[model samples]
Target: MAELYFLIYVIVFIVGAVSGLLYSYSIHLEPFVVKEKFNIPILIMAIIGWIFTLNFSLFSMIPSFILISIGVFLIGFVIDMRPGYGRKETIIGMIISILIWLITHCVIL
Candidate 1:
């Protein structure tokens, strides 16, 4: 039962990682490889956190999303505190993943 819910997160993680790799491109920011590495991983973690909280009704999703966003950003902030870490891509991916999750649960089937 609970294992099935965790399986959802595994799928989401794979999707996030594949997207990060598939869309890797050069940008004036840091580097796209950083996006594939740091960005996607953080997004994966965020999604997993969201999925775990999803045990509750949709009413709790909004708050779960808020916390997930905060946690991801805080992680990016801390990671960026170190030199050579890319926060921009991490934040971007985090936003994108969360939006997709929100819409899937809140809007579309």
Candidate 2:
């Protein structure tokens, strides 16, 4: 459906924006803490949206599922990058995220 494609496009745009926003040395962007509770609303919203679309003839739920998965992965990435976290853990987290992203796209999209 068009909504699925739209969500996929939005996700790609968001990742690109995040990459640039999180790494702007000229702007002196500082990393901030992201509490686990902060993501709960988004998680709930995604799930609700997916459930709402289940019987509808409009949006497909696959892209929303993928989006929510990536959002969770990004939260993990932020946690792993926080102070006192080991570099190995950050690397592993990123690797796992990449795998999940690839598998989700392959299996769902």
Candidate 3:
């Protein structure tokens, strides 16, 4: 059951991030249409994802997976609208991340 939830979370995170990226690029693209630009961040995000996956592989996969997910979600959210990296959106994301982390912890652990 826990593994199922973890897999679901992974899928949701990837789909959400990819879709968000595509949406963002579509809105910004003006001169040419290239998909490669959309995938450029995949490598970076993959590295970060791999590192988080390693941490999960070492410790509790469930909790670590959730933590990494919250991290990824925040990254995508901030990338969309950082608001100078130290504004209300950052604080909101942090608070929301904590609430999500706590809620998932309580439900899963």
Which candidate should be chosen as best, given lDDT against the real structure? 3
Q: Candidate 1, which ten residues in sequence have the lowest lDDT sum?
A: 19-28
- Model 2, range 1-109, lDDT digits (tens) per residue? 8798667656654564454344333234346533333334333433333332232222365455555445443443333333432233334444654555556666667
Give the local distance difference test score of model 3. Answer: 0.49
User: Which ranking of candidates, highest lDDT first?
Assistant: 3, 1, 2
lDDT of 3 by residue, 20-86 (tens): 5666565545554433323334334444443443334434646875766755653553344212222
Candidate 3 ranges with C-alpha deviation above 4 Å: 30-91, 96-109
Each model's lDDT comes to 0.46, 0.42, 0.49
- Model 3 per-residue lDDT at 108: 62
* Candidate 3 displacement at residue 101 in angstroms: 8.2
Q: After superposing candidate 1, which stretches have Cα over 4 Å from the reference?
A: 26-109
Question: Tens-digit lDDT track for model 1 on 1-109?
Answer: 7676456545555554444333332232453334235555545644544443332244464665444343433333323332434455455545665676688777886
Error of 2 at 105 (Å): 0.4
Best by TM-score: 3
Better of 2 and 3 by lDDT: 3
